[model samples]
Each structure stands twice: as structure tokens, then as C-alpha cells.
Target: MVFRHENIRITIIAALYFAVAIAEVMCELYAYKPLIYVFKPLMPAMLMVLYFNTSRKRSALFFIVMTLSLITNVLFIPDSQDLLFYGLVVFLAHRILLLYYIIRLLKINDYIPAIIATIPFLLVYFYLFMITNGIPENSFVVLIFQNILISFICGIAFSHYVMQDSRRNSWLLQCGILFGALHFIVFVEKFYLTGFSPTIFRPMAMGLNAFAFYTFYEFVMATEKSHRDDARSIA
Candidate 1:
């Protein structure tokens, strides 16, 4: 009965996650500004719930990350430059914490692979940099810093996955990082670049963000399971 109850809980959470994700996308597509405000923050809130429900062992670091993410979402809702800069600052701290967490699990003996993995991200950053014009100076600085940080995260995640290709947790972390980087790129193009259509890129960014958070949650669960297996083998 405990097992059954757990399964039921997971099912409900999964259903709600999908529903919230779809509503978020629809709000973007239809230009429902009011509903967008309602659903945007809910995205991270649902992720928090999903993590709480599915994780066998929860870490305070993960909860802190999700809470900051929620705050970032709220900060970005306004169309003011001051709020956007503040949002970027909060997000920078969020990424720094995430970087610390990922570094704790680093097992790479060689840095060559990680350096090579960063090339793609560098190229993307270059493209975005060349195309972006008329953005506020402060926002531009923060955006560049954020992109560089994300590139490092993606490179480290890729190298980690290469080292442990057979591990599901490694793959989950890799996907989550890649999805997050892509979402950030799309967001920049839609909001900062000229001649970009929000109708197309907005929903795309939102969907990618949703998937990234979901995979991050999965990565946490998979990592816990991997640790358990290692402990069992040692015993």
C-alpha cells in the first residue's frame, strides 16, 4: 500500500507538471499577459513539488537552487531594466551555486576533453554577441557573464558524462545543461535581438526551460540511486 501510494503521487505530479508546462506555452503563444504572470512562477514551483515528491533523499542545496529560480522567474516578469538586472544578478548566484554542486561530483582526470567541449558554446556566444545591438550596457554585461558561466557548466557536464557514459545520471545532467543553454540563447534572441518574432521564440524558450528543470530533477534522483548502488557494492 505504501508503494501504491507513492506511485499514485508520482502520477499526479507528472500530470500536473505537463498541464502547467502546456499552459505556460499556450500563454506565451496567445499573448495572455495575465495568465503568463500566473503560470510563469508556477513552473518552478511545480518543479519544487516534483523534486520533493520523487527524490528519496533531498538536499538543501537543491531546494535553495529551486527557490532562487522561483525568485528569478518573478523578477523577470516586469519589463523594467532595473528588475531585469536584478533578475540577472539573482540568476548569477543561482548558477554559481549550481556550479559548486556540479564541481563536487567532478571525477575528470583530464581537462582536454572539457576544453574541447566548450568550443560549441563559445561559437554560440560569439554569434549572439555579434548580433545583439542596442541592449542596455548593464544588461549586456550580465548577459555576457551569464552566457560564459553557462558555457562552463555545459563543458563540465559534457566531460563528466564522457567519463561515465554508462551512468544515467551523467546523461541527465548533460541534457539538463544543454537544454538550459539553448533556452538562454533563445531568450536572448527573442528579447534582445532585432527582427525576431516573440510568437515563435517565446514558447520555444519556455518549453526548453521546462524540460531543463525536469531533467535536473531526474539527475538528482539518478545520482542518489547511483550512490546507493555504490554503497551496496562496497558493502
Candidate 2:
């Protein structure tokens, strides 16, 4: 019965995600800003359901991060630069907490690949900053720092997967995080450098970003079950 209940929850979450993804594409193509804003936080709100089902140790942290993320997305709907900054600060806090959770849950024994992976991101940021001289100095600095934080989150995910092979779903979590980070940087650069509004692509990008959390949730559940099974075996 418990297993069936969990499956039902997962199915509902997946259906909501697919709905959000379709809505995102439609909004992007049709330039529906209002509808886009409406769907932006839908996935995070869905993940709030998963928060309750997960182990008690991490559920509160996960819920907090998702709540902050929902607020951050909503904040971006406004045109205020101050609002954008506040959103970024909230997002930064989310990442910091996520990093803390990842560290607590996964052993980090392999640092070389993670360090190597971050170099390319850093170099690319430098190259872009140097070549795009027209971008406002302030925007450039903020974008680069944002890129760094995203990169750190991706790197940590990758390292956690590589060093902890016992976790079955870590690779999925890693790929999801990496995709979200890279795509986010792409959109940010396009927005800041070329004067292109993200309306065309922000939906897909943000949808993908939200989906990563779902994958991470699955990873957490998988790991927890594995741990429990191991404990049963020992007993």
C-alpha cells in the first residue's frame, strides 16, 4: 500500500511536470508572459509534495529551498532591478543549502574531475567577459558570479556521483544539474549581451531547472531506500 501510494505521488508529479513543460513551450512561442509567469513555479510547488514524503532529516531543507525558489521565480516576474537582485540572493541561498545537503548525504573522495570540470567554465566566463565589452560592468560582474555559483552546484553534483557510486540515481541528478547550469548561463549571456529578451527561451530553461529538483528528489529517495535495505540486511 505504501509503495502504491508513493507511485501515485510520483505519477502525479510527473504529469504536472509534463504539463509545465508543454505550457512553457507554448508560452515561449506565443509570447504569453502572464501565463508563463503562472507556470514558472508550478514544478517547485509540486516538489513540495515530495518534501513531505522524504526522510525527515532532509525534508525541511528541501522544502525551504523549493519555497525560496518559488519566490525567486516570482520575484523575477517584476521589472525591478532590486527585485532581480533580491531573487538572485534568494537563489544563492538555495544553492548554498543544496550544497550543504549534498555534502551531508554524499561522500566526496574524488576532487580531480570536479576541479577540472570547473576550469572550462571559469575560462569561458573570462573569455566572454573580455570579448563582450559592451555589457554594462555591473551586469557582467553579476552574471559571472552567478555563473560561478551555478557551476559550483553542478560540480558538486558531479563529484558526488563520481565518488559515491553506490547511489543509483546520482548520475541522473548530476546530469540534470549540469544541464540546468549550462543552459542558464547561455540564456543569461544572450539576455545581457545581445538585448534579447528571454521570453523566447526562458520557459524551457526554467522548466528544465525545476525538473532537476525532481530528479534530485528521486535520487534522494533511491539512496534512502538503499540505506534502509542495507540496514535490514545487516540486522
Candidate 3:
């Protein structure tokens, strides 16, 4: 019975991580993009965040994926090739930037991390929207705002889930999902507005959702810890 429970737990975690990625990929294949498709990875990439192992591993894997994703993206949609390169560079910079935010998160409150981590993305998107591309109707800002909240909430949920059993993977995944969801929201808006079809957005989202595996894992751990603490108090 115990073995069965463990296996079931594992399956549930894996499934949560996988679902977002698969959904985004399917969306891309079926939907593609009508205008600027910055939101290519719509759902799939969210799941991928859970798969990253350690710091070194995460950096290396991220670099490789960013490179490959950029390459594939350029070949598939050659128009935004230069922009994609720039985007990847910016993403690389985020690794360092994330270090700064993580420090802030741990030092301050949990919510601070999300704001510090995601605000830059919003700023960048705003610049790209208004300056690079003419700003959309201010009314559209509401849509963007909602997306930001979605990403932030998703990050919190993912982070909480990852705290369970992911070890280092949990912390890293939490950060990834937090930022990934925010980015996804931006790219999707780009797609809707411009018609530049970039698949990175969806993949990024999947990567974020992958942290769901870690989220549930963390929940279990917290529950166990609480029980143990109670038992200790009783003793």
C-alpha cells in the first residue's frame, strides 16, 4: 500500500508538469499564429521548468534550449530572427538578474521575489510595445495587466508546489516558472498585436507549469513536516 501511494504521488507530479507543455505544443500545431506569434510555447514550456536539475545543469540546459529554440524559431519564422537573438541575450542576462531577485525574495517576503523578477519583463515588454512597436490602445493594458497577474499567481503556485520534493530543483523551478509565465503573457500579446510568430512564449509557459510537479511535491513535504512537528510536540 505504501509503495502504491508513492508511485501514485510520483505519477501525479509528473503529470502536472507534463500537461502544460503538451497543451501548448498541441496549440501551436493546431492554432499556429495569426498575427505576431510571440506566444508560441503557449502551454508546453510551463511544464519544462520542473525538469531542470541543478544550478549548473539549469544554466547549461537553459543556454542550450535558448540557443536551439532561437535557431528553430528563426528558421521557421525568419522575419524576427534578429529580434530573437536579442531576446535570447536578454534571457541570458536574466540568469544574473534572477540572482539579484532571489536574494531579495529570501531577504524580504515571498511576494517581493515575484515583483522584482517580473517587473523587468513588464518594462521590457512595454518598451517593445510602445517604442519598438507602436503602443496598443491603453485599453489593451487591462489585458496585459491580467496576464501579469496570471503569471504571478502561477509562479506562486508553482513555487509553493516545488518546495515539496524538488530539492534544489524546487527553488530553481520556482524562479523559472515565476518569470516564464510573465514572459509568456508578454509574447502572447506580441503575437496578437503584431503577427510575429515566435514559439518561445508557449514553451516558456510549459516550463513554468512544469513547476506544478514541484508545487505538489512541496505541499506533501509541508504536510509531512507539520505532522512530524506535531508528533514531536506530543512526545
Candidate 4:
């Protein structure tokens, strides 16, 4: 019965996600601000409901990430540069926390995979840097910083996924990285590139965020099950 309830809850949350995605597209089309507020917080709120467990470190960290995301979203709704700057700082902090949490399970022995993962990061970074060299000083710095940070995260994610024996967490992490790439594209479009980025990318970026939360939940479950199995063996 609990399992059934969990599945039902997951289904409902997924449905809501799809609805929010539609609303996102419509909001872009119509320039609706209310829809932004309604859906911006829904992802994290539902993430907490789906993954919250007092005993799990990943759960708590993810909750913090999402809470910060919600706050940042609210701050971005205003036109003030100061508010946006503060939001970026919080967002960067969230990324650092997330990076720490994901890397916690990794060990020094994982260096091979980690090094291999950096190839793509270097490739993407050089390509973007070459193309956007003409951007303004302050904006260029922010764009470069964001790109580097995201690339580093993606590199770590890919490397960790490669070294996993079960491959379950690895695939989830990889998928999350894929979505993260989409979000990166959105960031580039919004900050560096000119012209209207299609509203369609909005939901695509959010979809990546949903994938990240789900990946964390799965990691927590995997860790808890391993602990339980270890306890049984000891008994």
C-alpha cells in the first residue's frame, strides 16, 4: 500500500510538472508573469515532498538547493540589478553545495575517469570563449564563470557515473547532466547572445532540474538499501 501510494504521488508530481511546462510555454507566448510565480516554486516544493527524509544527507542538500532556487526565482522577478546579483550569488552557492554533495561519494581512486571527463569540458569552454570574446567585460566574466562552473559540474558527474559499478546512479547522473546542458544553453542565450530565446527552452531547462532532484532521491534510496543489506550481512 505504501508503495502504491508512492507511485501515485510520483505520478501526480510528474503530471504537475508537465502541466507547468505547458504553462511555461504559454507564459512565454503571452508574457504572463503570474504563471512564472506559480510554477517556479512547484518543482522544489514537490521535490521536497518526494525526497524529504530527515536521516539522508542528499535529501537535505537537495532541499537546500531547491529552496535557494525558489528564493532566486522570486528575486529575479524584479528589474533591479542588485537583486539579480544577489540571486546569482545564492545560485552559485547552491551549485557549490550541490557539487560538494555529489562529490562526497567519490574517492581519490576515481581520478582516471575524472580526467577523461575533462576533455569535453575543455572543448566546450574553448569553443564558447572563442566565439564570445567580443562580449562586454562584466558580462563576459559572468558568462565565463557560469560556463566554467557548469562544465566542471558536468565533468564530475560524467566521471562519477563512469566509475559506478551498479550503473544506475551513473545513468541518472548522466541524464541529469544532459538536462544541465540544456539549462546551460538557456543561460548563454539569456546572458550572452542576443535575440529572443524561444520560450520552449524554459521548460526544457526546468526538466533538467527535475531530473537532478530525482537523481538525488535515487541516490539516497540506493545508499539506504546498501546500509540495510550490510546490516543484514552483519546479523
Candidate 5:
């Protein structure tokens, strides 16, 4: 009975998530600027609801990350440069907290593997730096720092997966971080680089972000379950 109830709950949440996501994409494609304000924030808000309903062991850190994400989403809805900067600042905090949360789950036994894993992420960061253009002087420093944080998150996630190939949680974390990095890269390209179509990139970024949040939630749940199992074994 409990399993059936959980399944039903997940199905409802998933339907709501897809509906909101599609609505947001339609708003973006049709240039319904005002409607975007309604659907855009709903994306993360739906995820937060899903987390609260589905998670057996909810981490406060993850809850805070989602709250910050919702705030950033609202901040980015406005066209003002000041709001954008503020959104970036809030998002930086989100990433920092997310990184710390992931680090707590990781057990680093070999520094060499971790160090080697960061090399590819560093290369990607440099490539993005070389390619992206027209970044405002004021926003440039924050953007750079944010990208570095993203790289570290991706690197740590990748290294964790490499070390724990058998764990599903590791895979979820890796995919989530990579999807998030890709979403941000697309965002930078759309806003800063020339000739990118907002029609194509906007929906794409939103979809990637949705996947990232879902996977992160799964990672948290899986890790929490593992922790419980470990405790039981010790007992």
C-alpha cells in the first residue's frame, strides 16, 4: 500500500513538472513575457515540492539550495543589470552550498585521482573563457568566479563517480553536475556570444536545469538511504 501511494505521488509530481516546463518553453517561444513570470519560477518550485513530498531523509542544505535557486529564478526574470548581478550572486551561493553538500558525501582516499579528474574541467573552463565575449566589465569577475565554482563542482562529482563506480548515487551526482554546467554554458553563450538563437537555447537551458534538479534530488535520496544502510550494518 505504501509503495502504491508513493508511486501515485511521484506520477502526479512528474506530470505537474512536465506541464510547467512545457508552459515555460511555450512562453519563451511565443515571447509571452508576462506569462514567463508565472511559469519560470514554477519550474524550481515544482522540484521543491517534489523533494519535500518524496524525500524520506531531507537534508537542510539541499532545501536551502533549492530555496536559493527559486530566488535566483525570480531575480533573473527582470531585465535590469542590477537584478542579473544579484541573481548571479545568489546562484554563486547556491553552487557553493551544493559543492559543500556533495563534498560531505564523498570519501577521498586518493588525491592523485581527484587531481587528475580536475584537469578536464579546467581545460573546459579555459575554453569557455576564450570563446565567450561581450561580458560586461562589472559582471565579468562574478561570471568568472561562478564558472570556476561550476568547474570544481563538476570535477568533484566526476572524481567521486570514478572512485565509486558501483554506486548509483555517484552516477546521479556526476550527471546532475555536468548537466548544470552545460546549462550555464548555454546561458552564457546565449547572452554574451553573438548569433545564438534564444528560441533554441532558452528552452534547452530550462530543460537541462530541470534534469539537474531532479537528478540532484535522486542523489540526495540515494545517499541518505546508503547512510542508513551503513548505520544498520554497524549496529
Candidate 6:
């Protein structure tokens, strides 16, 4: 019964994911969002669907949503520059590595694997960003530092949330809340500072945040299960 319920939830979330992608593209058309050329937020959205979508039906919905988002981007922004394609391929490769590591590392606490994992994660983003964006000599080091710091902050937050909690569902929800709040703040900052950054940015940001909030809320509920498990172990 609970499994069925989670399927229903995944379906709803998958629909919401599609909506956010459309909204984000609209924002790009109007407000000229500079930082998100590579669709970074989509990574988190995929992560969300992966979390709740265990059943085939829900998984299909997730696959469709992600595919549609890609198609939407292609339809609207069909520039297809060499560098863009290059960076994109690199990013996809990096994502593959991330997904692999995320799954294999689950249930393991050893720090060695993590240290080994960081090499691909760091080099992939660093070299690709430099190549795609053409890092200026003067600001090269600074750019790398800033990017590294931001990624470190985000990754550490996820690690802390996931590792500190043995309950995977709770960890997932905490991550959702963290992501939701993070994007919300980013959207607001851009909206307030720039005013009318393509009508879509705000909604996309809010939608993503809402998505995060749901997962986080679910995680809260899951704590009860963890408590019960602990009680059983103690007994």
C-alpha cells in the first residue's frame, strides 16, 4: 500500500518536473539567465525522480519528463556550437560518473573511495568550464576557486545530510529541502536585482523548491520508521 502511494507521488512530482523545465526555458528567453546555460538544476530534479520512482510506471514518467526537458531545450536553443556540445558531452560524462559513484558508495563510510571519487568530479567540471567559458588569464585562478568553493559547499551539505542519517529517505528529503531553499534564494536574488528576468525564472525556481520541500517533508515522516527500527534493535 505504501509502495503504491509512493508511485502516485512520483507521478505528480514528474509532472511538476516537466513544468519547471518549460518555465526555466521561458526565463532564458526573457531575462537572460547567465549561469544556467548547462542545465545544472536538472541534475537535482533527476535525483528527485530517482528517489521516489521505484515502480516501472513512475520510472517511465521520470524518463519522459527528463527527455522532454532535453527536447524543449533543443527546440528553443538550437545553437549547437562546438564548444557547447563539447562541454555538454563532458558534463554528461561527469554525471555518469556521479551516478555511478552515488550508487556504489551507498552504505559505505570509508573516506578513501570518496577521495578517489573527487578527482573525476573536480577535473571534469574544472577543465570543461575553462574550455567552454574561456577562462581569462587574470581571473583564471579566481574563477576556479569560486566554482570549487560553491561546489564544495553544495556537495558537503549533501554528504553531511546523507551520511549523518542512516535513514536514506530522511537524507533524501533533507537534500530536497536544501536544494529547494538554495534555488529559491538564487531566483529571488536575480529577480530582485534584475527585475523581470524572463517571467519563467521565478516559477521554475519556486517549483523546484516546492519539489524539494515535498521530499524533505516525506523524510520527516520517515524518521518515525527509523525510531521504530532503533527501538526494535534495542529490544
lDDT order of candidates, best first?
1, 5, 2, 4, 6, 3
Instruction: Provide the lowest-lDDT 10-residue window in model 1.
Output: 189-198
> What's model 3's TM-score?
0.39
Candidate 4 steric clashes: 0
| Full candidate order by TM-score, most accurate first | 1, 5, 2, 4, 3, 6
TM-score of 4: 0.76
Please give each candidate's TM-score: 0.88, 0.78, 0.39, 0.76, 0.87, 0.32
Model 3 bad stretches (over 4 Å): 9-13, 16-20, 30-122, 132-139, 143-169, 172-178, 181-193, 199-235
Candidate 3 lDDT by residue in tens digits, 17-79: 455346545555455554214433322233234333212123343334434443333333334
Q: Is candidate 2 or candidate 6 better by TM-score?
A: 2
Give the clashing residue pairs of candidate 1, or none: none
RMSD of each: 2.4, 3.3, 13.0, 3.5, 2.4, 14.0
Better of 1 and 2 by lDDT: 1
Cα displacement (angstroms), candidate 5, residue 112, comes to: 4.4
- Please write out the lDDT profile of model 2 over residues 1-235, one tens digit for every residue: 9989987987876777767767765775676789868887776776776556545455577788778878877876666666766766676677667766665555556667767766666666556556664554445556666667666656666555565565554654465465556445544545544555555456556556655666777666676677778779999
Better of 1 and 3 by TM-score: 1
Q: List candidate 4 segments past 4 Å from native.
A: 53-58, 76-82, 106-109, 133-143, 165-167, 227-235
Question: On a 0 to 100 scale, what is the lDDT of residue 64 in model 1?
Answer: 89
The local distance difference test score of each candidate is: 0.75, 0.64, 0.45, 0.62, 0.73, 0.45
lDDT of 6 by residue, 1-235 (tens): 9988987887777666556555554655465455344443563455455454543223333344345334433332333334334433443433344333333324345645344434544564465554543333443454355345434423533554555655654456365345535433442333233443455555455455445534543443354455556679999
Q: Any idea what lDDT model 6 has?
A: 0.45
Of the two candidates 1 and 5, the one with more favorable lDDT, higher being better, is 1
Better of 4 and 5 by lDDT: 5
* Model 2 C-alpha lDDT versus the unseen true structure: 0.64
Off by over 4 Å in 5: 107-112, 177-184, 194-197
